[model samples]
Target: MNTMTLWHISGWGFAALAFAALLVGFSKTAVSGANTVSLAIFAAVLPARASTGVLLPVLIAGDVLAVLTYRRHAHWPTLWRLFPAVAAGVVVGTLFLVWADDGVVRTSIGAILLLMAGVTLWRRRRAESADGADEPDAVTSRAGRMKARSYGVLGGFTTMVANAGGPVMSMYLLSAGFRKLGFLGTSAFFFLIVNVSKVPFSAGLGLIDGRSLLLDAALAVFVVPGALFGKWAVNRINQRLFEQLVIAATVVGGVQLLLR
Candidate 1:
């Protein structure tokens, strides 16, 4: 591969990537489902397929920070229940990647982002309507099992395809009545394991290589500060306002990709 392929990014493009990398860390530590914006920015700045590869390592870095901060709060049983279905979905997603070209992937990612945003808004409205009637854990009952399996597979596929699985998993956790700390903790561990697992598949697909890794190295520095800032702000931040911002940014990014 020509070195220029990696280094061809302009200073402004690099700045954008650096900002996206920071958001990756911030999303991991503070807002569980906010990184869809990062995903959109990355895809816009780089080739769609290559963007996923370059973003994976940075996500892992953020995941590590999140896990360290919230490791104790993770719900193990939920993770166990979801893993098999998620693995199956990952395999299907790999097959899809084998078939898709860059343009198709880009369009698919844009669609997925928009769909996830819609789902999140719907879930939130439902949650508000239900109020105090928090549903029981979705990993125990037969209906819950089916629900987990459905979400697990969808989460796996979305994450594998576009690094857009956060919203799916967030919906699952919220529906299952995860408190804030538990949600963050479970999400932190789930993504760390899943994103790390994706490395070999991405490598096999040639999405990750020397050039992508080189770009990752350069962008990674920004993740640490972002994570630290998120950690500092997580408790103080206004949840409603932040979520609104996340949703708005996601819509814009999704529209841009679809139109592009």
Candidate 2:
């Protein structure tokens, strides 16, 4: 396609992408799993591989907004513990992209997300049964070095492959007993660093280019409103409801990806 043709998008396509971008901001600032909707929309609207590139800048913009809103509540110890393993996972995901087709990428990420959602739900159930209640401590143990590393690796790989890190990290944070603000704050920072790091790798792989950048610029404008809406929602939503919603979204998103 010509440059103009490549850049040109239909009204509905633009609207879909704009909504996806808004979801990015909302997910960053409030309900983390809502981003699965954004990812699915991007992949539907663009090539699977190319959509990740287009979404990255928009994610970073949301991350920046989230950081500004919840920077004070982040827990650095967990982030520090996860960094090395997360980096390794990113490398592995990068290597996978070298030979993997779009179908493989979609199905692989889908399966992973489904499995993770199952695990998170199962664990939560087990804890509730054991304690007769779903207390934070019962649901999630303290983040030890090993646990952090394992989740880190998974988070890195998923995020790198499909921008699906939010679910992985959300499960981890919930398990670790982080309340809403702390969870959002930590997630905001983690994604900012990771997404920025991926930029060079994506550009090198030709996933990012002038065309994608132009689209991202348009999408970025909607993120602010979404972020603002998220901030408002976060204050009112109950913890249990939030977690349940996230898990449901993750499962649905994974299924969509697999079938796509």
Candidate 3:
């Protein structure tokens, strides 16, 4: 499709896409897993393959805001440890996309998101039960190099295929005992780097185009307000509430994708 084609979307379609864009920004800064809603919305509004392209620029815009807001809090060592594995996973995902049609891609992503959401909830429950009512604000790092790499690979694969990396990374960060700021900061940096990395791959696959760029430009305006709101909200929220919201959004978004 050409640039003019995207401009023909109805007012309601634009409204939904704009809302999804807002969610993208909010998720980046406040609730990390919440962007899964944006992913599902984009898919619903556009073709599955085309939606990924349209959403990439918006995600990167959110990532930029997240980095600017949380750059100082990032943990570089952990990010460094995960990079190699993430690269491998991205390559594998790109190869998979080569043969997979939209139906295959959509169904596979839905199933994976559902499974990951279940795992995240299960882990959270176990952690809460084990730690008791007075759980520490910070979790001790249980992520060895192997485990980190595993999460990294899954994160890369999911992000590449469906922009569903947030939940995967959220689980990993939570497991490693990252609290609110640390989780946001580290995630902000990780996605900034990784999402930018996907640009060439996306272009090579013809996933991004002038039409998507036109839509993205319109959607980008809402990101700033959403991000500011998220920045404000994140500071006031307690840890348990934050985790619960993220898990709920992930599960709900996963189910939406499955049913779609």
Residues 83-178, candidate 3: write the lDDT tens digits.
888988899889988888877777766677677678777767865765332112322355477787798898898889988888788877776767
* Residue 45 accuracy (lDDT) in model 2: 74
Expressed as tens digits, the lDDT of each residue in 144-246 for candidate 2 is: 6668889889889988888888777877777776766777888889989999998987777677888778878989999999999999988786746766876
Which prediction has more favorable TM-score, 1 or 2? Answer: 1
* Steric clash pairs (candidate 3): none
lDDT of 1 by residue, 1-260 (tens): 33237446889999999999999889999988788999999999888877888889999999999999999989999999999999998999999999998889999999999999998898788667764322237467999899999999999999999999999999988888887788889999999999999999998988888877878998889999999999999999997888888899999999999988
What's the distance in Å from true for residue 95, model 3? 0.8
Local error of candidate 1 at 245, Å?
1.3
How do the candidates rank by lDDT, highest first? 1, 3, 2
Give candidates' CA RMSD values in order: 1.8, 3.9, 3.8
- Overall local distance difference test of candidate 3: 0.80
Better by TM-score, candidate 3 or 2: 3
Please, what is the whole-model Cα lDDT of each candidate in the order they appear?
Answer: 0.89, 0.79, 0.80
Per-candidate TM vs. native?
A: 0.95, 0.85, 0.87
Off by over 4 Å in 2: 1-8, 123-143, 238-250
